[model samples]
Target: MVQEEKIPSHVAIIMDGNGRWAKKRGLPRIFGHRAGVKAVEKIVSHAANIGIKYLSLFAFSTENWLRPKDEVSGLMMLLSEFVDKKFFEIIEKDIKFVVSGRLIDLPDEPRSKVLKLIETSKNNTGMVLNLALNYGGRKEIVDAVNKILASDIKDIDEKVFSGFLYSPEVPDIDLLIRTSGEMRISNFMLWRLAYAELYFTKTLWPDFDEAEFDKAIFDYQNRDRRFGMTDEQIRRGNI
Candidate 1:
């Protein structure tokens, strides 16, 4: 069971392995993507119900654009449909819908829908659902730097630089969950995941459920997040 007091403020997930899951079941990859969307709906609702402040999902990466045209088109269509269907539900649940990427890169219809969702939910006082669509961790850093260079500021630190991120309102990730047995971050959130507890599951994204989420939370609670402190210092509450 997850300890309510210790619930992570921000949880980021690298939803992976839709292709492999589809292959295993002798179905098209799009089928797996569709199933993954169902799992996303379940997780988003559960996260909000569990008092998570921010939930960041790696929905689409900038690199993902290199995929076959048909798959990409299907994904775009699916995304548009999802936004259309979930707009009302997001409002009803008081969830803030936000995107953390180059929104202009999206197709016209989906981009319009995404913008509408963000505008509509901007004032929601509930959990933030941050979708990393067409996002790249390295690109984010580069863009931040470019913005800094364009400014007149001569010097800055990490804290100051963070304000230039795509979703600066969202805090650093507390726990990062990667599914499909992946052992890597895959350029998800390089800056924000600096000290996050990593939880990797072999379960495919389509199969990840509330139980799996709880298991990850349970594992996080058991670990000692000493950061850079020694074990003795942690024991002495010298954090």
Candidate 2:
């Protein structure tokens, strides 16, 4: 029998190139960031409708703090505004909003907004929308290691270690998509993306709409995952 196309249980995206998008139009970078917000809303709603269980977005990274102070400030304000505006709508849609990273590292206003968003959506039983803010892949690994070291348990394996990460409830990523033509992982989620099918597009994040999102999922469905098994094994349905 011909194998049916598989739907990924979890999808992660590195939203890149907002600043570049704004620069090309001779507009402030914050304008691109603002436009990216609408794209985010469209993609999230579309993903939930299409039966994707988990959607993790790399919103802000540890390295992003190295940007100019004004830009960082603008980003923080935008994040706060996003939460305030979208919290109730997401709850009504039965989507659970989650933020994973060093929460304390964020400014007071954004941090408070994030906490409130999580609290209000905590009861929802639906697709997860995970925002990785002030997050780094290597840093997450180190943090997990520290958690394991402090514990009394002796068992150390992939499953056990995964529980120590910031967001352990979510499963490993099945597909990872990066926009703006970026070719690197950029420390988004090191451990979770081990065997994920990767997709890259030249389209900037601000302009990445539902059609672009559909294309990413379509590309992912075409990938044949072996998980270290031989091609013959896969063909024989042994994987």
Candidate 3:
């Protein structure tokens, strides 16, 4: 069992290198995407089983829209199929599914599936599974600002500004994990990941199994999240 005090309240992941995995195997990129979905399934189940309060997966980004049409189309189909196949299982496990980003960019089929998942998972009281589709950190901040400007409240702080984000119900990210050795944040969860501990691994998305995930979690538990306080201040529990 995880120590309650050491568990990260929120964890975010950037699932990268699906295309590279497929290419290395002399298979189509879509093959890797399909495999990556399976990895997602395994990780989500494991995270919930471990009592992780929040898990965010970077499934797609705004930049991903610039990819080849055929590849993009395949990704959308895979997403819809994943929802259709996993919806019932999610409900049975009492896991809440949440999505971040603009739904306008999604096709009707996947959009419908995503909406259905969010609607169905509304009452679930367990771990939240967040998907970042067509999402960008800069865009999120811009949207938040636009919302703040449109409102009558002249004074704006971090707490009030956060309410305009896509999934304000979810708290700030505590741990951010990116696979395939990527060092960049790639414009995901800009505001929510401000204080998140970052973990980077060379394992591709399809290969990121429970063992790899556990390593990340274990490392997270070993960190000293002082949040800018002095060592003495934190030791005294007065910061």
Candidate 4:
């Protein structure tokens, strides 16, 4: 039997279409958000099982604050519930939970819960599951720059600035998947995805499952990631 191809070191996702999925079903948008959480649980477990070292999910964006208050509150509530319900299972699985993006804007309770969860899972040896909450790509880059400027180093290189970002140890994204037919990155991991392969699907987040994920991986495996080198050079160099 053929062995499965080596799993990607890191994978990022733009979990879009929750609101649209809800509207299509004539249900409250929060319902879609709630269902999306189930998808998160399934995908994370499968990712870990399949040997994906790092998984990043765009859970909340900085611009998400503009959404309806009820929806935002519901999202936070779901986050709390997820933490309360999954912390032990996550620890048992040895999956490390990490949060990216701004923390100051998050309400005290949710912020505290996130901190507790991260602390509890910090030493886990399994996949690193990163939740991008209150996250924006441009804002993250700006924050990294500001942090670099504040440091003692006079000259800043890309490597130096990158080390200041939220989680410097995480590898650059290898594949970024966006569900709901979205074709854009939507300010999710702008710097980190500089060389990442992107996959867009019309399947809504609620409907996205292991099969869809496998398709994305299959597509990624077929890509010619030459980066900047010529095809002939890559062919000879065994990239």
Candidate 1 overall Cα lDDT vs. reference? 0.95
Off by over 4 Å in 2: 1-5
Higher-scoring candidate on TM-score, 2 or 3 = 3
Q: Rate the local accuracy (lDDT) of all candidates.
A: 0.95, 0.91, 0.93, 0.90
Candidate 3: residue 172 Cα off by (Å):
0.8
User: Per-residue alpha-carbon lDDT of model 1 for 1-239, expressed as tens digits?
Assistant: 89999888999999998999999999999999999999999999999999999999999999999999999999999899899888999999999999999888999998999999999999999999999999999999999999999999888999999999998999999999999998999998899999999999999999999999999988988899888989999999998
Model 2 Cα displacement at 85 (Å)? 0.7
Superposition TM-score, candidate 1 onto the true structure: 0.98
Write down the TM-score of every candidate.
Answer: 0.98, 0.96, 0.97, 0.96
The better candidate by TM-score, 1 or 4, is 1
Order of the predicted models by lDDT, top scorer first: 1, 3, 2, 4
- Name the runs in model 3 displaced over 4 angstroms: 1-5
lDDT of 4 at 146: 88
Output the worst ten-in-a-row residue range by lDDT, candidate 4.
1-10
1-239: candidate 4 lDDT, tens digit per residue:
11267567899999998889999999999999998999999999988988899999999999999988988999999999899889899999999999889988998888999899899999889999999999999999999888887889998788887898888877799999999997999999899999999999999999999888988888888888888888998989967
Candidate rank order under TM-score = 1, 3, 4, 2
